[model samples]
Target chain A: MSQNNLTSVVVGNRASISKPRLGLARKRAIIRFLFILPTLIFLAAMFVFPIIYNMIMSLENYTTISIATGNAPFVGLQNYIQLFQMPLMSQATWNTLEFVIGSILFQVIIGMAMALFFKRDFPFSTFLRTLILLPWLLPLIVTGTIFKWIFDQSHGVLNYILMQLHIIHAPIGWLISPNMALISVIITNIWVGIPFDMVLFHSGLQQIPDELYEASSLDGANRWQQFIHVTIPLLRPVLAIVLMLALIYTLKVFDIIQVMTGGGPANTSQILSTWSYTLSFQDMSFGQGAAVGNIMIVISLFFSYFYLRFTKES
Target chain B: MPRQGLRRSHLTIIGALIVCVMLFPVYWTVTSSLETNTQIFATHPYLITPQFDWQTYRIALQTQLPHLVSSLIIATGTTVLCVLVATPAAYAISHLQFKKVTWLIVALLISQMIPSVSLDNALFIIFNKIGLLNNYFGLMLTDCTFSIPFNILILRAFMQSIPKDILEAAYVDGAGDLRTFIQIILPVSKSVLITAGLFAFLFAWGDFLFSVTMITQNSFQPITVSIYGYISQYSQSWNQMMASAVLASIPAAVLLILSQRYITAGMTSGSVKG
Candidate 1:
């Protein structure tokens, strides 16, 4: 039955077939194109068109007033220049880098620890591992809200626990103090991010053959030595992918900071994404907002180039 | 091996402790929702609800029910539409020989890194010009910007595993390309379809940036926007706010519980394949 079907399919593809069959072949190609057309149209309209429009909008003097009047005059590089001049822009840039680096470092470290710890099979290890993914799976707004309450100044669980342990003399303003607000959001972000790293590294660890570890042990290697020699070397690809992805994702983070601190304590926690939002919606400077947004895109593009490079290399 | 058994039990206990610490925030959200104003502000916090309390939930539901329904509509609409557009595209990408398909896949991968704010900025203008603003259909369509490419990537990965011979068999039986996809491929790709649809639903349901940007009306606001709104309005009412947070999380939590396997498979495969 299979041989018969294969022969028929092969014959159907022959160019030497009848003219009528040639028509059928053309029709099949058209049908295949039709299958992909809707997706193409959607992407063109939503993704491609908007990105081009965004670049155009960034060069114009667009604002809420201009939007209403429908006359956004072209001002080449003016918006970009203004973006540099804005005081909050530099602060936001620094905060964005800090947020990304701080969150990624701790998330990777803690996630690696958790992954290595849970590498050993034990009763209910799988169940516990799944439970830890709760933070990552929850909506960002939900995570933000939960953390907002957890870091509440007076009645927060963090401060309460610290006070109970006699670790602090007074309630620390986790989200209220300017010096601490960015740190607070980063902590929340790290908590949300750890599970992603953990799961990815967990799977990566599972892929390394057990024999490598056994051999290392047989060679008089301690557990730490085995991990350094056998595990780290083998996990490099997964590690690079995880770091790049975490960077890209963290750089675009908005909801967590927006909800937790509103980039608050006087813009100390403000990042690029939220700053772009404030520029467009709150400040009514749509052109500058688009420029700020374009800046973010450039930064993301830099990271994405590396991401694609790493994924391709791996 | 005998001594290792003792260490394994010790590791399990330690793992349990770690999980407890990590999930404490989730637990606190639930308990805080049940606490009274006095209990919430007490110098010492109650680790558990002192008594059974549902007032916060009652109030939350009374105000936020419409928003939840709005979320359900948008999420479901986005999921259905995303799967519809992406499934056939995924099939074509996997089975058809198109020179440009590789470039298209690269574009799709690049789209994942584009910030939602940038999209929202341009979309706000375009949607306004086209009069799609404040429309559920419009919002649902925009939500697909995130989910459709993701669905295509995942579904294409799954579809590539479907043996070419089976498709050829269908073709030899005089089934058209669409027919082969519908009749032969769709049935086999059921699990992936579910995974893709579930992710689309979750993405749309949890969306905040698009919701705030596109829908300016209170009536059209999804639960995320409503919850954010509730925070500012009822900033003093922590219990009610926590109640709303818990309410907003129920769908995701329920899906996680019921579809743990699919979620894990989807997350792991989606990352690895990308």
Candidate 2:
């Protein structure tokens, strides 16, 4: 009878001790929630709210009403359909495509060349590598303005230099000409993009084993053979990442074109980003601007999905 | 044997030529910034050295770059706030076993994919409605929209490599989650925090689209829009323009120099194969 009573007393004591420990664990969980509260609040106000607001704006004929009023008539898909009919819209889309393809191709080609050149570990290589980042390091506003001065028709530095060299009989109106304006923009983009690609590719190149190249050469491989067989395969994943990021950066380029031409000589150089800005602010077609922006979002989402998918597969 | 030597010399010469061509645009900008307007108009523009005038630097220094202070304040505030807010959030994502975490990450990724241009029009309207237009707090909040997702992604990767037993041991020692995070996780992850801070700083500092769209007044504008004001469709202020451009590059250049190691390390984190 005494042993049974002692056992009951010990069991009662154990239950009381465990209760407070469970309470402590619950308290810790609640504290963790509080820690994350500020970030959640920030996202709700800035990101989540704005996204919901944009979707609502896309469905209305907000052209006639002041945005401050926020009482525009709903028009369903009218803004989106009308967006496809605008000539500048089509031209802007085309320009964006050309910009992406052209910029990516040249940037990759030239960047690869620089990567190969800088990979030699020669004297002044580190200085040369750092110096090459100057174009990218400078503000885009500065780069665009410098190029603007360089491309000036009469009494500008570019024309003056060309004439001094006797390279051409007369000056070229680089910005005013529609055909040349986009390419001029591409030249600047290429210059800015080369540094990023060089850095990424150089990192990729450094990871490649010298032993592989030595073995290839010993097996009667040429310079081109080593690059094709050994280098390309090793750098494939890095190349994919570099190209995807470069594409995203190029797609959103606005400040340079805005500063250089104001999308001028008849809006020839306008990409989707600048076009959307002009529509909303300059043209006061808020709904149409929202529509254009939606389209850009769709394109970005599509490309990002593909990139994510590709990354997962590889 | 002679042919091989010739080929090697040919490659070196070709490489040198490409480097010069690659460097010409940037070289031209710095050199031109030194030249006077009269010299710039000269038929044979000097590429190397005819004269050096530090007048542009002086003008850039004295021109009352009104937006620089606002930019510095906003960028610095965003960096500090983001590091404080994101460090714990990233730790939770990496270490904790919460149910809704993956969905949160996916949502963040989707938010990032949606371009800033898409949100600009709506945000302009929203800010105008709330009377938050031209407010630094409003702009900083918007920047965090991009910065948080990227910071979370980068930090999670950095944190994943850290062993979990350290935190588990801390938990067994009667310490709570908060104490473990403060003492164990943060000290070890300082480099990654600096890396994320650099990215956030540069993005907020150099952004043109959000600043121009959200902030309407000239005085409220960042250096980007202010610099654009110096250029017009017809007339241009070459001297003041270059001055503004030079001034605008300073914050970003300073950012790059201070965090050069972190930038290189951050780029190689996922890009290069181990």
How many clashing pairs per prediction, in order?
0, 0
lDDT of 2 by residue, A103-218 (tens): 99999988887887778745556556765765666667777887887788875676777777899889988888888888888888888888889888988899898899888888
DockQ-based CAPRI category assigned to the predicted complex of candidate 2: acceptable
Q: What does candidate 1's lDDT look like per residue over B1-274, in tens digits?
A: 2124357788899999999999999999999999888888888889988985888789889999999999999999999999999999998888776668878888888888889898889899989888999999999998998899888989988887787778766765778778888888999999999999989999999999899889999999999999898887777789988998999888888888888778877777776677
Per-model DockQ: 0.63, 0.45
lDDT of 2 at B59: 73
- CAPRI quality of model 1: medium
Badly placed stretches (over 4 Å) of model 1 are A1-20, B1-6
> Which TM-score does chain B of candidate 1 obtain?
0.97
Compose the digit string of candidate 2's lDDT tens values, residues B1-274: 1115345556556666666877676567667767777876666667674878788767755653578877777778778877777778888777765568767766666666777887888888888888878988888877776687778777877987787667666766756778988899999998999898987787787777788877788777777776776677324446556656667777667766676667766655623321
Q: Name the DockQ score for candidate 1.
A: 0.63
Model 1, A140-168: lDDT tens per residue?
A: 99899888899988889899899989999
Predicted model with the maximum TM-score: 1
